[model samples]
Target: MHASSRHGTVAAAAPARGGRGGRDRRPKRADAPDWAKPPARGKQRDFKNEQRAAGGAEKTRQDTPRATTSRSERGVRASEVLRAVAPRTSAKAFEDVSRGTTVLFDDPREVTLEEQLHYEREGHVCIRRAVEGVEMIPMVKAVTGEIIARRLEAYRHRVSVLCPDARTTELKDVEECKRALKKHSQEDVGFLQTFNLHRNESSPAREYIMSKQFAKIAAELMGCERARIYQSCVFVKEPGMAETNWHSDLNMVPLDTNDFVTLWIPLRSLDEDDAALHFANRSHRDFALPYWRTIEGMSDLEGRYEIDTYDELDLGDLTAHHGWALHWSPPQPKDSVPRYALSVCYFADGARRLETEELRRTPHAEDEWSYETWLRDLQPGAVAKHFELPIVWP
Candidate 1:
């Protein structure tokens, strides 16, 4: 069930008032995200059936990755790699692309037959706490504002300080910067994304994105030996950012393979009303939509496919869906703090560019960043092996 189908959100101080947890979105720092603070001592909100199984404990049989049991001893848990990789400023993600110098364990891991079948039938699957090190995600909640401040500061430094242009606005602080970015990107209608933070090498996200843990999960789900990273993006949906219209990620990219998968990792516990992800079950199998529907606005495919989503995604829980699967999310009510999620896309190592006639004519100018950064100089049907795209698995 999606958020609208659920009756409650995270507990707050306003059960009696009955309006968005009765939150007052003012006084700057006082409006701390609830997930960052310890849960108040009181009656635990009736979560009904949803599980908060942290550190990979308390999982049902269906939720367990059957392939990881015996192999679990050999395969490195996600946390191990994160702790091993010290944050360094010089190295970028997958820096040792062909050289086999990565610190992570390189053993093959598999998904249970049931899980694979579920993904085949539904086009998406949720794996709870499989990426165990995501327990560190709560820290991301604290630094959400800092990320905004730092990024805008860098932008101001580049344009206003260095170039001395009248074009740039005198963005005062993080709040003003946030408003400017929201207006710049139509954050209510679209999304705010920062990609490849791992390129900085000093970012903690670098370990998570470059680690073989995510690559192995992608490979196992797609039944492939190798999964090459196409990109990693951290998506921020702030309070008051409206719901996003339904669209497919595959529609925006130039890749031409059915083996592509995107893993969505929540950096904190998500509330039912606050940006809960919704997917069109099995929508990828019948991909007749030939153009980028995002540019065209809300798609009308909801009538054709069933919407599937969890009421909530706890910290460490993640969802991996096929690139062609249609998905979107609801608005974050003004009561909530901004929610941050990391989405990493991986495809089979030998996947190539579009070869079909209709696909060849698709206008990809809107996504020129991806083209210049990784897809440049490639003809149709050529293997997508740009230096930026690295093979993260066997």
Candidate 2:
């Protein structure tokens, strides 16, 4: 077994009994604690009386009225028991017990305050069945096909023979674009990233992005008065794609606040072996950390944080992480199916653009799109409220 250590490294755990080393031999009673000792193999232990005894005197009193008591009588009995116990028990203990047993069976999708606190502290939270009953497989296939078609069209102009409807316009530029695409295609193109799908108002992806269910959760997780969808993209990672290097989204974007968040929704079920996303716990608080410029830079900061990841996640399960949270994914397995995921980035309302020379100088694709084009007109310290970044929540 592998366990994550405090410093984000994988720790080896002792193998289970009867595992590869044949370590199932029973321990001597002298060395084992009374609670740890198992009963004789062929003998049966009588646990009925013990169970009844362990339930205490209160259990007997509670059971006496179950069959004959009216609903009001049962409530009175419960009240009486509470009164009797109230004097002896600490208020905190009683409160804890009450909280432990208080269940609202009707609202199954509720997120408790404790969970919100965890998200605040860890900078990320995974919510199971966040968007149920939505068939993601078909959506994934459609988006994948669209991206491929778009890429082919962009590259076709470069190859004269490949262009079906060749016109006399801009042949030189077309050839240049095709050559660039051909070179990229020859390499291990890790994933097909189709960004700004929401810009196309008629796209199905746009409708999904604007759904109230998704926007509400994003707003809640962000603890923002409102949230706006700044960017949306579909990532299709084919088999044998290279691992995504560790990095923080905030460093790559021009946003001034750490209130920015990203929602990662996988199109299918994924296990740990499927290159599921991994995060460095509470690393979002490390604001002094410089922008990750190289793989070596990421490695240097590994020891400062503990890594967190899900062992398995079903479809409809999604994860939301702070923009500054350090995260990465392993390389796609050679034999596994392509991994398709939709990523939507949300920024808190009133977020401003940062004036960082480093961000301006960075040659990353995200910087170019998010800063150069999206926030081109807005000066540093200006509000990030461009038409391209629309508010999705209130």
Candidate 3:
């Protein structure tokens, strides 16, 4: 079920206190949830350890075929890629001649489904007018306001409320929501906490929303065998927040196919005045260079801001060029009011590993360092493990 209907309640299985074994205990870290942590206890290991472990495990399994069971052999299981190819050109370079030439181009609504689907197939991304109506807007607006207040409080005043730093308020606010809910551990709080990861043992929200009705619809709409709630996130656009730079979903998990999607449900009525999130419309069709690069420079380096450089990458032009190029969340003017939205990501079943190795190697010193050498030594089987819960919302 959509988390909105189940908001403010917890499940019966929730631990009564903090800790893994309690009636409603969910994991917590400073301003972050324990669920987001690396899968292993030792957080200092590097990527080399992971590579070596992954490699070694593969080798051992190959050599002693009888030792491991079928499930054990299916490491990092997601649907296999239907095809592979040489890296293609960056879709960002294409110019849109239609921008001024066509009468229909002036009206975004006049754009046909064929145009959108064509872009989606080529670019691997697209967005549309998926929802509307005035009543829905007000409800989302109220929920959004509460979300913003909760987010602002959680940062303990760390948010900068301006460019560069401002771009990240959405992420910060999410961390805050997690912290607040984790701190209270009440049934109602737990329900709100499920905005991202809809798994709370004591979630009263889950009890009400866990019917098969929604799941069946979700699976049909999403075109998957099962629809599971993985993680939830909220997006808030206050004045001066940087337009979210261009990026892709796969870099976070490094998946193999287009087997995942994010359901973005706005909590307020969206209009021209509000900063509407623009998209490439079909960005997923191409191999998305880790969008993280634009923010962090490279996958291995700590991300630094390049506002002018990031802003200059014309998104509309790029979309027309390769179809795979797209971006969303334009910036709000310094004098304008902010917008609020809630979003969540869902992957095909068994798409993620614990990423303990990556976490282990990441330095906590808050400075630039390299994790490459460590990455080379990683063994296949040495990666930390993650387990899927028996989803029983119904």
lDDT of each: 0.54, 0.54, 0.31
Alpha carbon lDDT at 302, candidate 1 = 47
Error of 2 at 36 (Å): 44
lDDT tens digits, residues 1-394, model 1? 2222122232221111111211221112222355543233232232222235332333342242211011112222222222232333332333435411233334423566766876788788776545343334533643354356456553433233223222446776556655554455322223455656655556655665676766777889988987788777777776666555555677656677788889987777664555667776667887454433222212334444556665555665578899888777756555566677878888888888664342522332223334445443455567776667777785
Ranking by TM-score: 1, 2, 3
- The clash numbers for all candidates, in the given order, read 0, 0, 65
Best by TM-score: 1
Candidate 2: RMSD over Cα atoms?
A: 24.6
Indicate the worst ten consecutive residues by lDDT in candidate 2: 14-23
Better model by TM-score: candidate 1 vs candidate 3: 1
The superposed Cα distance between candidate 3 and the true structure at residue 360, in angstroms, equals 15
For each candidate in turn, the TM-score is 0.64, 0.62, 0.40
Off by over 4 Å in 2: 1-110, 133-145, 151-188, 288-297, 356-363
Residue-level lDDT of model 2, residues 1-394, one tens digit each, is 4454322333232110000110122122122222222223223222234446777654453233211111112121112211122121211111111011111122235555754776788787777666442444445555555666555442332232223234424444545654554544333334556677667776655656655566667778888877888787777666666556556677656667778888898766664456567776777886555434423234334345556665455666678888888777656666566677788888888888665432322323323444444554565567776667777775
Residue pairs clashing, model 2: none
